[model samples]
Target: MANADDMLKVAAERTGELAAPGMSSRPSRKVAVLACMDVRLDLYAMLGIERGQAHILRNAGGLVTDDVIRSLSASQRLLGTEEVVVIMHEHCGMNGGSDDEFSEALAADGAHPSWRLGAFTDLDATLRAGLERLRTSPELSARDRIRGFVFDPETGSLRDVESD
Candidate 1:
């Protein structure tokens, strides 16, 4: 199995290939996409985005955490990224069970004892919570646009939950 460093080296090589000469000239659409870290979801291909088009911020469940807000803030101020797309997908491990259930499972598996899963099972509720979190975050620019989406992993379809 490849170690973390090995995986990183492979990723760097792939990124370098995509960022070769003439690739830097492609205009970025100034979009920020918040997506899950699920290997099954490809943010670039799903959005029809080419190289250097948007800034992708991924986490466990695609929830709008403080770090995401901070990154989005920086992207808005420095990277010309003003539009945000928060994508949560179907069949997500994050949504498979309740927070308590997940926490218990983690403990049973000898994971971190302090692990407390964030509640994100309800699709609509999770989307709304994420949207509201971004909208109300002081770190975000006042003029920034935010949208929510639900990606179907099985069908490879994107459904807009709410547009800006």
Candidate 2:
């Protein structure tokens, strides 16, 4: 298990020097990727992107929500991002349950979230829905640049998903 002391060491090492300085303030790839906050998934390495290359937004399932829309709205309209890619994966934590049920369980465990959990019964549907959500959000500026994919956790492969 990770400890607070180890985290402080990591932070100290990180702040000691710039990992990849001299890159532009804007992402070099000019893209933003919405991905799940999976421990096994390395967003930059898996996508062949580097630090300062793309903006990555991560959450439980990488499901599009009002908060995501707010961040992306600024990423595009303010930060010069031109592309959006959503990456959902198999065997996700958000699968296999209803949001209401999950919330109830959380409440029992003494944790309560007022926000929507964005749970889904179908992975592919959720993936496509995230793409469409970004495309249709009136707050986002680059609607045409949005797309979605499903990642295979076992094989570390991403399959293109139809965002109809």
Candidate 3:
């Protein structure tokens, strides 16, 4: 059996061959976006961006955690990314509950009653919270631009939450 490194090397060579020559030579556009891992949200299509146009960082609720800060810092300082876009969508699964409630639900068995309460919850508060976290993060340069938007899954419209 091939080792993990050998497998990775094979994959990397295959991916390099598939990449466009311009993408392989140039750094991506100077934008770093944080968005949810929701299947309904299509980042490139929605933002009208093509491949290699931006650096996308996705996670649950696109919450601004420590790893996000580290990545954002590197993107700005090392990769020439000067803009941050936070895209939170409506009908998110990570809304309408405290962190404790979420942790408790995760720890419970498959039949936890609280799990039902967690679905299709209002995501406005969480969206605002994520925006605020980005605004207050010291890792961002003062000149760096940060903006937040809420994508309505029903209407397929994006609403600006805040801008900096």
Candidate 4:
């Protein structure tokens, strides 16, 4: 696990070099990308997008949860983003995981949350479902350009997912 103090120290040291001058809050590409919070998946390099090119939203499993919808709505309506890219991946931790067991574990710790683990066995199907959800959602102002993909970290390959 990374130490917060150490991370902060490093960030403070590099803060001067990390400045992005004259970059607007709005994405230059007018797109929002929702991808897994996996350490190996470098969205900027993988998607060939720069820091100011797209709004990047990351979560476990890359599932299209309510919060993701909220962010997407804001990205499209407020941030001038018109397209969305959903990227699920091969060998995800969510694959074949048990949500009920996870919930029970949380309950054992005396912490009960309303959210599910968003686990799924099929990566392509899950991506397609998330894409469909986004496409049909009334919350997002721009749904026509939404696309989904499956990334293989081992092979460094990104494959497009077709909605069923």
- What tens-digit string does per-residue lDDT give for candidate 1 at 58-149? 98888887788888888887777778889998888788658887777887998876545666658768887899999888788744578899
**lDDT by residue (tens digit), candidate 2, 14-133:** 874655566676888889999889887888788899878889999999889888899898988888998999988898988886889878888999998778678888999778777877
Candidate 1: segments with Cα more than 4 A from true spot: 3-27, 101-116, 142-144
Q: Candidate 3 — what's its lDDT? A: 0.74
Q: Which ten residues in a row have the lowest lDDT in candidate 4?
A: 155-164
On the 0 to 100 scale, the lDDT of residue 126 in model 1 is 89
TM-score comparison, 1 vs 3, better candidate? 1
Indicate the TM-score of model 1: 0.77
State the C-alpha lDDT per candidate: 0.81, 0.85, 0.74, 0.93
- For residues 1-164, write the lDDT of model 3, one tens digit per residue: 75999988888889866668645322367788899889999999899886666889998777777788888888777777788888888878776546656556666855544322333255666567766777788887633478789998899999887533
Best by TM-score: 4
Model 2 misplaced stretches (Cα beyond 4 Å): 14-22, 108-112
Q: Per model, how many backbone clashes are there?
A: 0, 0, 0, 0
Clashing residue pairs in candidate 3 are: none
Per residue, candidate 4 scores C-alpha lDDT tens digits across 21-125 of 887989999999999998989999999999889999999999999999999999999999999999989999999999999999999999889899998998888
Candidate 1 versus truth, CA RMSD in Å, comes to 3.9
For residue 88, model 3's alpha carbon misses the true position, in angstroms, by 0.6
